[model samples]
Target: MVRVTGNEASMVLVMGVTGSGKSRFVNLLRGGSVEEGDGLMSVTQECQIVRVKIGSELAYVVDTPGFDDTTRSDADIFEEITTFLATQYASGLALKGITFLHRITDVRMQGSTLSTMTMFKELCGDHALKSVVLLTTFWDKLSDKSIGARRQQELRQEFWLDMTAKGSQVRRFDGSRDMAEALVMRLVDRPPVVLQIQRDIMQQGKRLEDTGVGRKIATRLDRSLEEKDKELEDLEKQISKASKRRSSRDLKQLEERLGRKLTERERIYASRQKLKASLGPEINAKVEKQQKSSPIMDKIQFFASILGMTVSVTTNIVLPLLGVAF
Candidate 1:
């Protein structure tokens, strides 16, 4: 386990839906214990950062909370994740790459799983696809190897077609430490790219809700609220019928369900409010302050590094504009 004092280390974000083996994958790299969720309930409620020595480079592997969390709404998960990414980006910490894990044993991709993938794409944007790795795990658990192979092909042909076409790599994780290290080393060796969400927050000065992923989340929340309202309405009618029939047990169950749904609705409302809150202004302020204090060359280098442009391009194009001879 390699430890670093500063936060300037290259970062790799690991993400997927619940039960996708994200934490386990991180543990493999760190060679230490990271709390793994039991069955499908998400144990990683927040981002857990682990430091590892990938060859000569010290990298931070961030295990993020999975969507479909039992205790939190999807909106809550989204806000928590985006806030971390925005803060890191503003602080000049660019991700080396992103690894998205999926369970090969899953018979088919559920709606929530598909939504998570779509949200991830929106979060990373097209420019950052070259720095992403799509990983399918749980191959060791598959009794029949052909089943896993078929699912992998399906993902390649249908779900992952766009990402692969855009320069993302798709690889099967064999649940080995050697494989984990190899994957992470591949990422840390590449040039760091700024994710679209990061650019939206820091450069565009856009509110979280105005970001592409944020807007997608808002749409999902609105749809969830609508569905919850319909559920509550149906429950109300059922409760009324049960009460009229003097069925205490049925009425009690209906009332209980209604109460639970109402609580869930409130959580959704809270997430919506969190989404509307503006995080861009504060980050932009920090950026402004940093730019003011730094020298011209330093600023140029800083921007060039985070913007994912090559040093040669920055030297040739950007320096020329400032009347600086190379």
Candidate 2:
């Protein structure tokens, strides 16, 4: 419907592990109050766009749900983020850069963290690395500057070196508004390039399931299905044993958990199966229909034109009685 180009507001995507200070970082940038969560809870569960000023210009910063959110599955987060991004692109929102936050205090990169990063890479693709900012956050929590620096160096050498080698810039966030503003200012001037995912869907006419990310997610779903099947079998055996022992309380809890897991398993299978190998003419026709029906700018311009006519009417007729008060 909406043409996605560089004419709209500039958008910067902030993402990474949960509790890595992503919301706090965005709060400083936008100078707006976004809840900074505590403990194991992730603050941002949906992708939101906030407008922040960079000197004389205004830009948008997209605060995203964290990758390791305990409350949601990867599929849930992925679906939300993907839907938001696709909608934005469709509406002509031009993306400037993506800032990935990592906690400097974490001594080891946990598996969930790594899985999140892998998912991030798959979403962006190799070509989009040039627009990535590998930002290390929560630096103020570190007791020693050298420790942080050394850890940063180790990351460049061990994990992020490949990405940096490809054009991603690694920077340390001092958890200051100035630093956040500086990062936004630097990236907003760059030419907007369509992300690989955007290109795959829009230009190549590929469905979500055909992209590299869709394939990766499908693989995970398959493995998860296998695990769920095994768990289901084990739960059945346990339920049988509990039935013989007459433990009603334990049986009830186990049955409830079994029902939940079964529902989740079915959802995963359905999600995987619905992803088509390719987007055909039906999708194309729908897009075209949306484009025709959604003439938002034209409607606005019509109202604006009416306003212009009202001004003319005021000048010629109403002023005749007022007699040049100004």
Candidate 3:
């Protein structure tokens, strides 16, 4: 187990799209057995915190679910994350920095990738961007290093320009425990910062939907609902024509399309509902859930016992089972 001697340890948050190597990165750091997601599916559905010994200080490294999660809505993911951040901030635990992972092998940034980046920016805001690191992963998977280098430059110049200009860094995460620790140590000395979303909810007394990241997600959902509605309309027209013509094959295809569209619409509506619901009750319920089964409580209580701090389940942040020491 990592030893702590200070009033608080530095905390770092790792964020990225699903399959961007978040769990793998945390596992590398602590020699922990956090389950890594296959490149297509996400395994770290909730925030997973691990204790790591960086030089002499211990930092709590948190792994978060990405925006385009395979099984959960973005709204749900955002709410869960908000619970973690709000708890930590209210407990007086500011983060030293945040690391955003990305796959170096992706040829270009997709719409989903751009949207995730936008959310990250909004969550951090301008001032906190200085503490952000854009860590690119999967370099070893690239066949031609030159192509990857060019893509990296494109990210800094185009897609990630705003963040880079605002003091966010772009670095490559070579697949090694040493590199991961190095990334964490880079921000250990910088004064801890309260993220924009944390301030919005905790200090400014803003509702979840009123925050910057919240507004971005809401806008995206609105556009997606509109697009899906249009697609449903188009499918309805095609189905109508197919029915009038009595073409069995086309009618079957159109009907199947309509069914898929309806299912998607239902999911979109559900996500919207989650966004509209109150956050206080959800967070309180999550706290209750963690009280019964979360290993994070064990770790936090352990910290409290050693550090002489007052740690309680009410502010218990979600932590997955993690091995101790690096």
Candidate 4:
């Protein structure tokens, strides 16, 4: 059991079933390169910690062996995760939250997946309430709009509803490069206990020396904090400007735009109804006529009719195929 001796940062354990892209998720979390070897085939046999420094906050992204491993008993896996958490806590590490990653491409949520999640909550006690985020991964695989929409709906209906019911934060995440950056930013802004731990580490380091290793570490941390603060200030300014713009906008213009859009929609719907009514009988008659004909004979006759029509039209013209083959 590895003990966290000092002010350990918050740990975000990235966990899910085998082939659910846990390692890839961890790589994304750490802003590291996700290589070809990083697949669903168990890249991590044990718990591995990747530390990231984001604006003076230390975000420890923990990657554990895939849950729902066929070789490992369910009880064994659950105990392992619990033991890892216990060790972290014992070592003075703050539990930030657990990102229960599920692949978007999963046809259905497995029973084992749900069981592990429940076990995690049970192990964490009340601390799990605020720290859990059911992070759905592999969103890139859901490129088809219709399929992606259905998958998202299923997740919301099946998993997110229950998670929210249990007072857990549930969010869908695309494990793409661009989305990874956004996720990191979000983690920094809403840091778990790990950020506090990082601050403690930096503070302690700063007190040691004015130059050398301590000074370099302190300077880097300070710079990160300053950058984060600046970003927050800019975001606040943008929000304020947006709010002011919204307030200044004319209500009458909005109302008029809404009315116009409604009127246009109504007109289009009415025209479509009218057209459908007019074409209904003709279309039905044609369909019935075709349906009454024998399938093979109909196609034969259809081609025959076209050939005959062409010949008759040509016969009436000059040269007329030498007056019907002389």
Clash number by candidate, in order: 0, 1, 0, 4
lDDT of all predictions, in order shown?
Answer: 0.77, 0.70, 0.76, 0.48
Worst 10 residues of 4 by lDDT: 310-319
- lDDT for each residue of candidate 3 in 82-168, tens digit (9 for 90 to 100): 877766664445589999999999988888888898888888889999898998899999889999899999889998888888888
Off by over 4 Å in 4: 1-8, 31-40, 124-127, 181-326
lDDT by residue for model 2 over 13-123, one digit each (tens)?
889899988888778765444667865488777776566656555567777897678777666676566655554455455688889999999898889888888878878
- Candidate 1 vs 3: which has more lDDT: 1
Could you tell me which 10 consecutive residues in candidate 2 have the lowest summed lDDT?
310-319
Whole-structure CA lDDT of model 1:
0.77
lDDT of 2 at 163: 82
- Runs of candidate 3 exceeding 4 Å displacement: 1-7, 223-264, 277-326
Candidate 1 C-alpha lDDT tens digits along 57-87: 6676788898778788777887778777876
Of the pair 1 and 3, which is ahead by TM-score? 1
Top candidate by lDDT: 1
Per-model TM values vs. the true structure: 0.78, 0.79, 0.76, 0.50
Clashes in candidate 1: how many? Answer: 0
Question: By lDDT, highest first, what's the ranking?
Answer: 1, 3, 2, 4
Best by TM-score: 2
Candidate 4 residue lDDT tens string, 1-326: 22223333444667767777777766654444233234545555556666655444555566777555655433334334434443343234455566667777777767766655554444444434555566776767766757766876887777667656655665667555344434443443444443222221232222212313223333434555456555556555655665668853554454455465555445434322322122223323443454355233322123223223111110001111111110
